[model samples]
Target chain A: MEKIKIEICVGTTCFVMGASSIQALEFEIPEDLIGKIEVTESRCMEFCKDHKDGHHKGPFVKINGEVMADATYDKVLDKVRAIIKKKEEN
Target chain B: MKEELFIEIGSAYTNKAGQDICGDTIHFKKIEDEMRTITVLSDGLGSGVKANILANMTSHMALKFVESNMDLLRSSEVMMDALPICQIRKISYSTFTIVDSNINGKTKIIEMDNPPFVFIRNQKEQVIKNRTLTSPKWSERSLHISQITTLLDDRIIFFSDGITQAGIGTKKYPLGWRREGCKKFTLSLIKKHPNISAHDLANEIIEEAKRKEPNNISGDDMSCAVVYFRKPRKLLLLSGPPYDMNKDKEYAEMVSLYQGKTAICGGTTANIIERELCLDCEIDKTSFDKKIPCASIMEGVDLVTEGILTLTEVYRLLKHNIELKNDNAATRLTKLLINSDNIDFVIGTQINNAHQDPNLPVELEIRRNIIKKIVRILKENYLKEITIKYI
Candidate 1:
């Protein structure tokens, strides 16, 4: 199966804004999703620091090119599941 | 249970007999009668036999002095003078950090020039608070005395550069354990096995550090003195004005006399303080917690930044005090500052028109306030009587 790419921002700004937990997202995803999702740790996507909607919408994790805010465990998990399900359908 | 304080020490170094004959030595003694636990960590120059001798000698000398009930300055001086200097090396120095307090469950730390000690409680690590202790005759290098009383159940960690130098993750710098990694590692251990012994815990940390380093460098001989108290330690705070050149000259000369440990924070300031103090210093970019103005003087150790040098010594002093620990936190912080016998009279300086508030820039001020809260808590619980002199 083609892996659904997941990128995590490990920059200072993201790191300070709870990216510490984002770094652990790979482990939080279920075992079956591990094969479907490729969690890539990146050094400063730079875009995470770009202000959006008048808020510091950073510390983000991009799943299959879809950007998500407050990229917490549950939220990221949901995104990972939807991507995997869609990949299976395709 | 006997309800008596018991201490078991396990020390190893590069010496001939797996003993620290002349390296950094941490001495712990429990005075059951006084309910006081005396813990001392002293760092001598170099490693191996000679260093072992110096460190061992320091520990012994400090023990004798403390046991004799002599004043802290007198004790440190006696130990410094007693060191056997090598004719060829021409340098045999040792820095000290000592804690003495009654067990009514109160713990006070009397620190000279040693690395900042950390206390672990509720699985979180916090550096012990200290103040500057000065003696006129020995105040070069700023002989400082810091007394801190803390509640028991808090585990106080005293280490030489050896432990801190343990590399971790990709960044191969000492103090590189990366607070989060170290914190997580420590917390995980306790959480996994609540009954783990302190000895085991210490070994785990050392082993982990060794494993993470690429060269598997045993690194410097590692040693840590950890005191796990069951209750809060009492405290006394004492501080005086910043360094007064007129009066500080003698103190500076005194610090010059002893071989003590020195820690410098921020990049550029570490360079200058190392040169001025004639002591080996390690600079850490990620070391200082960004909350307060950076503290330049810790225990007997001085911290400075590039900005301070350009601005002026007085500005550095004011900015530093404001940033690192707040003016009010001086109470408990005085306990940690008493690391050097040479540090006397804190000389605080800053350029300010009466009309202007000398507080740091807004962002830096926020950091300062966070540090302030921590310092305030330390002062409320421990420390007393530290003076501030603005130049």
Candidate 2:
């Protein structure tokens, strides 16, 4: 199985808004996907309110160099599955 | 007149009675002669009014359940199941603790899963136990109170984590009063004033904590239960078929058969038996189970609290009163009752169930099997003489 890197921003702005869910996602994912996913807790993703959503509107996470904003557990899982599928196609 | 002992009761509130943020504490003396007393302290998770409601609900439900009908173990199970849970939010939870002590100086303590309890005994402090992530977040910790027999007089202390978090004495860590710090403080108090009443000591500790740090922390809704014991009384327990209204009379008759003044406990039927038999009875009010009738009659007895906790309390009561000696005795008696050989007749009943679909009995079997399982566990763990009979 090929490995995919996952970065979760624990930045003060994101954390204050709703980044708490990411830590939980780290543990909830199944055992088969454990080593396949690398979770890094970074201090700041610099998500500005000036973007698509309003102020304090983010919990940004990156999957294989693709940035996903307002990331939720389900959204992250879907992205991870897609990433794995893309790898298999190659 | 036989000397009837009364439990001293008292309460202290944060504001004058009928105020908004009512941080109040109520405690009663241990049920006479039986060194055991149950103390419940609930710190509603939030602050101000919402906190008050949560705290009150937690303490009221826990006390009413434990003190009235259910034993410590059963009450814990029922309350944990009953508390409301919000699936979306994780932090909205109630943290509570129960400290049950016996006069012979034995104590059993339980803390819910959410907020863990700090056990401070003999100048040593430690977290009671941790709850897994699977447990409800509202329930910080539910600890089985460890037994403390050697202490000359045991004090089952409980307080909301707010007291520990206040950073009064020390604040290097976010968690305050700390299990170790509280333990050392309590032990020092015991050493300094061996005769100081528990009530006064609790107040002193609060005052000292407040004086140490005056940081807008209004002593996070404090409450504690200070229990002491002198002489031990034997425990007497009995239970008939589950939800068997007719068996109430049989239980009353059995209590009457015993020599001591009986405290008949049950619902309306148990009350009826008390009237007919002319025996004392008291209702176990702590239970939310509507199936068991309400009412017990009592005469000149010091104190009467909950009736049968579960099949287990029945075992404890029988052991202390009848002296069955060990597992062999309990097993033999259980075999007799299960086989219906010893008792001339055995009765069973059914309860209304909304969830039953196809082939399940509305009411599960409540006889010697459940009783025997509890007895076997107790006998294997601790040696006690208790026996039960079914008819």
| lDDT top scorer | 1
- Kindly list the per-residue Cα lDDT of model 2 for residues B280-362, writing each as its tens digit: 54332232122221222256432232222223334553445443333232233332322121112222232222112133223
Please give the DockQ score of every candidate, comma-separated. 0.02, 0.00
Instruction: After superposing candidate 2 on the true structure, give the runs of residues whose Cα lies further than 4 Å from its correct spot.
Output: A1-90, B1-19, B23-30, B33-35, B68-74, B80-92, B113-142, B168-175, B215-219, B229-391
- What lDDT tens digits, residue by residue, belong to model 1 across residues B1-391? 4343322222232222244453677666655456555767788777777776787788777766776688776776666667887777775577776766565555666666665666667666765555665666555544545444555345666666665555634465645554355456767887787544445566676676566565776556666665554321222111211134354333333334534333221222233334455655432223222222223333355343222211222223333443334331121233233222122222222221111223312212222233334343323222212222232
Model 1 residue runs over 4 Å out of place are: A1-90, B1-22, B86-89, B136-140, B168-171, B174-184, B230-391
Q: What would the TM-scores of all predictions be?
A: 0.42, 0.38
Clash totals for all candidate models? 101, 37
Error of 2 at A57 (Å): 85
iRMSD per prediction, in order = 12.4, 25.5
Q: For every candidate, how close is chain A to the native chain A in TM-score?
A: 0.77, 0.78
Error of 1 at A2 (Å): 67
lDDT at residue B178 of model 2 (Cα atoms): 60
